[model samples]
Target: MSSNAELHTLKQRTDNYAYVLRCRETGLCAVIDASEPDSVLELLARIDGRLSLILNTHHHPDHTAANPELVARTGAPVLAAPWSGHAGSGPDITLKDGDPIILGRLRGTVLATPGHTLSDLCFWFEADRLLFTGDTLFSMGCGRLFEGTARQMWASLTRLRALPADTLVLCGHDYTLGNIAFARSLDPHNAALLEWEATVRARKAVGALPPHPTLGLEARANPFLRADDPDIQKSLDMPGADPSDVFAEIRRRKDHFTA
Candidate 1:
C-alpha cells in the first residue's frame, strides 16, 4: 500500500483485536471491528482522526459492540456483510464478495468467508498486501464453525491460502500461543511449527505481541491451513482423505482441546 496509509492494531476485550486504518493524504480513517467504544474513541481523539467508515467482519458482539456508539459519535457509515446484526441502525452499506471498498487512495476488496459466521467478510488490500481477516482466519488456527459448515470453512481457508505469499494477515484475535500448542500436537515434527512456537514464546516473554505472520508463513506453519498437505493427512491417519474432511476433524479436536 501507499506509505501514506497507516495501520494501528489495537488490542481489545481480552484477546480481541481492532484496527484503525488512516489515510494520511485525506486525513480520513476507518475503524475495523470496533470492539471497545471507549478505547476506539480515545484513540481517534488522540490522533485527530476523522472517522469516515466503520467496518465489521461479522455480527458477533465482540466485533460489533461499538457500532452504535461509533456511528452516533462520528456519523460514519457502517459497512459490513448483509447478514450483519449491528447494534446500531444496521449497516449503511452491505457488502458482498468481490465488492470494492475505498478509503481515500487505498482500495480493498471484500471476501465472503463464511465459516466462523455465515456473515464473515475479509478485507484484502491488494496494493498493500494487508488482509484483515476477522474471525474467519486466525494466527495458526481457524475459527470454529459457529454458523457455517466445515466444508465452507475449508473452502474459505483455501481461498485465503491463495493470496500473495507476502500478504500480512491481521486477524481478529491473538491466539498464537494456544494455537501453536495445538499445531504442535498434530504436526509435532514440523520444523516450521516448532520455530514459530519458539518465536511466539520469545515475544511473549518480552511482553510483545506475536509478530503477524505472512500468508506464506501461515501456509507453512498453520496446521488448519495445511489440511491439504499430505504430511498432515498422514499424521491424522487420513491419507488421501478429502482436505475438507481433514479440516473438519481438526476443528472438532480443537473445539475440545484442553491446554
Candidate 2:
C-alpha cells in the first residue's frame, strides 16, 4: 500500500525472469512466472516460504512449466488469463482484463495484452509504478505474434505505452542486446538509441544483462514503441503508412533478424 515492495528478478535457463514480489509490511509474497520449480523453490526457501500466490503472464510452457510443482509445494493458488492454455493444473483464479489482484497490503491490476498469445496479461502495480510485462512488451521490441494478429499486438503495445513515463518495466526476457541492435539499424542517427546501445554493450561485456529500463527510456529508444516515428517509417519504406502497418513490417523483419 505504501509502495514499499521488494521484487526479486529471478533469471531462469531460458533467459526468462520470474519476479518474486513481497510486501514489506505484511511479509506476503507472490511470484510472476514459474519457469523452473527448483529456482522457485529456492527463492521461496530464502524468503522463508511466505509465497501466497502464483501468477502467469501467459500460458507458454517456458513461463508456466513449474506451476503445478510450485502449487503442490506451497499450496499457493495459480492465477492466469481465463483463456489460458495451461498444460499443468488449471488456474485456481481466472483473471480477466482489469481484474484486481491482492497480495497482503499490496494491490495490482491485470491488463490483457494479446499478441504473443491470446491470453497474455501484464500485471501493473500502480502505487509502485511497476509493470511486469510478459512477452507482449519487451524493452526495445515487442513479442512475436504467435497467436494474435500484428494489429492486435500493436494495439496492446499502445496500451502499455500509455502508462506513466516513469513506470519501471520488468520484461519477461533478457533480449535487450539483440533488440538494441535492431533498433539501431532503423534509427541509426538517434542519439538516445546510440547512447543506450553503448550502455547495453558495456553491461554484456561484463557478463551482465541490461538493467530494466523505465517506460520513458523505452518510449524514446525502443523502435517498436516508436513505430510512428518518421525515421522508422522511412527505414521500412512505408512513410505515412498506418502505425500498425509500420509495426507489422518491423515485426516481420525482426522475425528473420539474426541479430
Cα displacement (angstroms), candidate 2, residue 35, comes to: 0.7
Q: What is the lDDT of residue 234 in candidate 2?
A: 85
TM-score per candidate: 0.96, 0.95
Runs of candidate 1 with Cα error greater than 4 angstroms are 84-88
Write the residue-wise lDDT of candidate 1 on 1-259 in tens digits.
Answer: 5697788889999999999998888878999997788888898888878899999998888888898889889999999987633444568899999999899988999999999988899999998889999988899998999899999999999999999999999999998889988988988888888888888889899988888888998999898998899998988999999999999999999999888
Flag clash pairs in model 2.
Answer: none
Which pairs clash in the backbone of model 1? 1-128
lDDT over C-alpha atoms for residue 220 of model 1:
96
RMSD of 1: 1.4
Clash counts per candidate, in order, are 1, 0
Q: State how far residue 178 of model 2 sits from its true place (Å).
A: 0.9
Candidate 2: stretches off by over 4 Å: 1-3, 83-86
